[model samples]
Target: MNAGPSTAAGSAELRGEPPLVVDLDGTLCYSDTLWEALLLFLKHHFWQAWRLPLWLLLGKAGFKAALAGRIALDPGALPYDQTLQRELEHQRAQGRRLVLATGADQRWAERLAAHLGPFEQVLASAGGVNLTSRAKADALVRLYGAHGYDYIGNSRADLAVWQSSRHAYSVTRKPFRLADGRHTEHIGSVRPQPLAALWRAMRPRQWLKNLLVFVPMLAGHALNAGALAQSLLAFAAFSLCASSAYLLNDALDAHDDRRHPDKRRRPLAAGTLPLPLALAASPLLALGAFTLCALFDPLLLAVVGIYLAATLAYSLRLKRMLMIDIVTLALLYTVRILGGCAATLIAPSFWLLAFSFFVFLSLALLKRYSELFNLHSRGQDKSSGRGYTVADKAPISIMGINSAFLSVLIFMLYFNSQTVLTMYRHPYFLLGIVPLLVFWLGRLWTLAFSGQVNEDPVLYVSRDKVSLTVLALCFGLALAAT
Candidate 1:
């Protein structure tokens, strides 16, 4: 976002004119400090969220102060608007006074001012009174008199303060109506369209993982139209649940994710998606998923509940454990098959369970291995939010390859079983599947080791022409055996 031409009175302020007061949240910074405080509170002091209403009953200022005291907000890591920062610097160079006025707690406001280094004064929430709207307007009016200072802000709450200012500049493209005939210019187009950012934050691409919900129906050859419809419903529920988990993870991991080159562009980390919106959407999505699951089948709903619990646990803690992390990921994948079984009333098969564990474990290990490889290439020794290190690269590779081979062994054992003979008229034809599995697994690991498999292994296979062809051949072989 860039600044537009300032009004004559606003531009005159560049030559030692009246003070310029800038709102902090959504004006000076792309993200809101209040939302940052809320996220930090939920991430570290989650138990305190229940007490927020009680504190707010006392007042907004007191609530903000209480929350801000507990959160360790890093001012330097905040998503400040680059254009606003540059404009502030330019105004500073001209010896113009800059004041930061915000409804955010004074503690956070001070830290931000200290970090940014241009603000001469910070007027913010304090003493149980929230400094916003009318309060802010009154304070500025008392300090600088009506129309004595130029104000810059974004939200509608800023309208009250802008009414008292000499001129207004904003971070929004929407024209601010000035009843008092004061000039208003849009300084930059900073915030993303809320609906679009929310959609992106849901991460539609990752929903591909939920297709695992159809595994059991396909494997059992019971995929008639009715079963297909049920599986589709199950798929939708899992997708919603998965998106909820992802939003929770992204919000909690925002600080760490910002340090990563690729992850920094994620909506939450980039400050394009509002943190409050993410927080609101997560539980709503989870509820919607559970509701849909309940309407389908109680057993399926229970399985989905377990999946959500396990996923949340993984995001909160298990993901940091060494082998346990990968094991949990494997279980999460296997649960999808369980969900499918419940949806279709298919009895659980040991072969399918074992195969899923081994395969997904290998893929999970590949994910970590790729992360370590990237860190190694960057001269970093540790993987963020993970127990793995650059030195553990060889072990991860060995384990991933071995796990993949173990899955192949499971497939071979399944083919040799009496169950295979009972199910297939010509079970011998299934031997063709073994070589395909071997080739796919071998090629997958080779690419991962060579840093070619940089995305989720499932997503990789979905996009890879070679993997797709091998998969088709394997399916054909299985059909011939049956």
Candidate 2:
């Protein structure tokens, strides 16, 4: 413990000043412990989630204590409001008593206090009592007498406490009106617009992957306006569903993401985006996706249901498994093509499925390899939330390289099939795409090996000049064949 300012206690004795009490969630800490603990509980003990309502029946305090007892959160890893912390330290240096008063469970309060404080006292929820709002105000009034202490807090729940305190300080973006007609000091400026943060969290760039939904329509030569419109609708639906999955994945991974070099900047992980909003938006987005699917063919909706289920499974458990995670990722990409076929009422060709599977499989492996490579570069042996160690890098690269070549071979066989003759006016023009595919895949792996590829390979390809150029060339070749 940092016993700040050796003469602080003696100094406070000379001056009779009110103790400074600070809120925990959203005031001193950028995150809510309850939400973080709950998400982690669900992530690790999903089966026991049925007990949540039962626990809640024990009242808010019991529910919080139950969760704290089950999972141990690292207080040091939490995102704290640095500005507020600095102000608290300054006050402590001035010999003002600092109190940590929060609605969080006593366990978390004590842990956080020990990790980052010279707090004179810790007040929090305990013994089946939830210390918040009116209860918190009443307790403080009883302990320090009404208007005898200064308080710093955030959120509407703090209003009652502010009314009971002598001075009010806030960390919230919006100004609050104190019922007691006292001034509330704003500590920091408002964060970036919620819409901007939401947009980033939605990750519209990844929607590029949803473009695969148009592949079946293009391959089947269903260029009619009606077919094109349906494919576009399928694209929109899949994009929304994919965003929903991304939100859920980010929420579950927020803790682990903080340990990552790049992912730590994600909205939820960085605390720029509120966890409750992310959790709420996730299901709403899924509902909107399903609503869009309902406007299309029934089969398309069924395909989307499968896609959502698979994505949920992948986010929940499959992603933590070794090889299974990679295969599941490839299957998700193939599902987009299936959605296209269902939307346009086109039968999927065996060759199309075979080529897509191997191609996406290779890309999936590349994604994992990139993550492992980053970890290895940092001298870490194991990935934070993954099953792979640095030692698996070589085998993953070999398998990925082979999968890429196998996909090329599948495309070659596809060019020779009678199906190719029916769709192309000049079938031999399609052969030009083979070398382009090989070069693109080889270049991607080379970058991964050299540590240039630091994110998902599919997302990387969207921004990669060389890969985009290769894609354009392949498209031109296909257009000539058509």
Candidate 3:
């Protein structure tokens, strides 16, 4: 259905009106099909990602052609600009010939044209030459001659075509009227303010997880200016790394996230944040993290690198692997504590590391349990975008509770260890931590079982008043023992 500009003019003449040509990416739709295909490529055929730059060397049109050939996007699922659609339908009803003219590969443009149905003709890139800017203008002029067609487009690249058109309909964030007597109608509503959406995407509140990097200083009783500075640097490095991981996760999950009620509103899934920006920011943030860690200690940098690798694995594949996903999540938390140890040059104690692993394992299971609960409540049989089934809920609850109890046992054993006796003035004061932990764990599990927990367990604890009070009491007791 990709008809040339001449076909558009012929069709326009038969309809007795100028054809309406609409830009696809960023104009008729809020998203770019190229970026969409790229993400889909990474998600399903990730191994083929290294081939991307090679394809781009041929040119943007060739790159897009190669990518579009590999992935078939469901046009009905795309986030189209509803206002534009309504306006196009009105014009279509008035006997205007509608044409979909875009720089996107002809395959996707054709698919979308058929899916959306307003476009009688699709004018798009066939191969080497991208149909944009001057090329687009020439094609329009060849078909309809000077000022014989109307162009609706977004971005500066569209200005060339707009200038050649009888009427210029712009989709822009800023407002202005055409002064050269070319008629224009501004389309699209005021875009949603992005600052709040960006903040949510960064998930600043989740930075609390990086506080684990301070645990080594606290455990080593080295709370001096030097140790505090080291710990702060570690916190910054880990926070940056964590944010980078979150950005990558959101980008990769954008496809599935759109299907979730709450997650659909995420910056990437909702198209509030552009995909190219997210892709660029991820690596820059990771580099900043590595730089901070390198300045602190090479060993710290190494640990941060491993943490990033593990997280990337989790985001890419491990998250789909059933019970292994929870175990990997636990390991990720324990690695943060290890990062703290490296930052402060403290030797990790087996008792503390073991305790961290088991506790975090329980919390990880709680996260999955919460997700399952959400699905079960909605009468769904299985967790969406996950491997877990609703039938496994009881077993997960049992395993989570067992892991929690095991962490408490490890803490009790640590109190009886020679290390505790050597490091503490009053070792028995540490015993109080066990009961406090028991109560907190029990409360958390009880809440999760009743389907009251929707957030990650770590995040839940950070915001809960009771959890905060228990944490303070546990810290006070540990300080008393020290």
Candidate 4:
């Protein structure tokens, strides 16, 4: 977030008239908590309900619009300690001016700014300016003159505004989970105890990813009749099944996660979620999911078995292999799509699967890249496979390359396919790749580079702007072709 004005060297007279410039992220709203909630939201609502290509078009602006309606983003999103509240109040009681400044976009800044009772104005980056430290420093200098008022912050980056301010204060308590790699927010206590914590632990984002099963059937309406019913059943079954896996994974990872800065706040690691309860909950959820599948389609039950096995393998073994772990994740997603096709007796084009894998792999690689950056900053070795360690940067980059190419290759092949030709009703629909390519290559990689990329590909796309535009254009073209 933008630091307040720097202090002048000589005297109080030299220090420009300082309005209170408050940082948005740590000072006002806790980023860690919001992100966790956002992750949950993406999994449950956006991911499953929105088509990937269309979701890609929603971008951050759209997502922020979504958040305004769905979340209580005002001052309530920022649950702060009593001590901080008094400190802010003390500052407010003073004649000092108040302005909310942050590295986050104007939307978030405004959302947060509206709730800060005393702030005079909110200054934030529009497209990209407000997201990094240097920019924040520049903003502080531009907005608040030399030697301004005392500044309050939480992270090392705040050291910039901290050092420059006449006086500074830092908060030690953080309200985010340890496993959460977002370092902008400090690790803090979870408000709710074991029960609420367990509910949160069941990740809804994977449920959105599970919607992959529906894509093929939607793409091919001939399989729509009976397959639609079966697909809906699979979706329900997998949602419960994935929740079970999340509970089990959190329990197993509690030991390791406790060591993590963010994961430590997780229910099990924090001692809020009891181990026995989680142990009981895991298999029971799984069994319930499986039972539902059994009543619907044996083939679906088998697919869920594979999903369970793969996830178990991931929890038990695969997560340690770095590149292999990512590959496994991609395959698992592909299998979900393939499994649906099998259950419905519909054949997915080989080219389609190829394209899907590559596209997802690209996003998976971006997640790894972000992980590597975070791990390296923490002075951890990247060689460990569970989370991308900094050591294997080459493979991650190479995997991204392959994944991008695969997306192009798949689309190109799809262009030649008779199914696409028949459905599209126009040879020109093949040109849809122009926007798709630009959207994918530009938008996703930018997020990865910016360290804003989400672990789930669908999540990342849903929050990107340019990608969404291209996606919309492509869809409009497809409609025209049809």
RMSD (Cα, Å) for all candidates, in order, is 2.3, 3.5, 4.9, 19.0
Better of 3 and 4 by TM-score: 3
Positional deviation of residue 296's Cα in model 4 after best superposition, in angstroms: 1.4
TM-score for candidate 2: 0.95
lDDT assessment of candidate 4: 0.63
What overall lDDT goes with each candidate model?
A: 0.86, 0.89, 0.85, 0.63
Per residue, candidate 1 scores C-alpha lDDT tens digits across 315-361 of 87788788899899889999988988888888878998999899999
lDDT of 4 by residue, 1-482 (tens): 12222223222332234555566554454333234334334433543545434533666444444553454433442334444445455555554566666655566567666665667777665642434355665567666654465555656666666555545544444422222232222322223455786787776655777888887776665444687887878788778888888887776555456566666676665655555677688899999988987876787888889999998878766777757888887888888887777667678887778888887787777767776766767788843327554667667877786778768877877877787766767668658655578566756766666666644556656666766777677757756666
Give the runs in model 4 whose Cα sits over 4 Å from its true position: 1-193, 223-225, 383-388, 455-457, 465-476
- Output the better candidate (1/4) by lDDT: 1
Every model's TM-score: 0.93, 0.95, 0.89, 0.57
Better of 1 and 3 by TM-score: 1
Q: Give the lDDT of residue 304 in candidate 3.
A: 94
The TM-score between candidate 3 and the true structure equals 0.89
Q: Alpha carbon lDDT of residue 148, candidate 1?
A: 91
Best by TM-score: 2
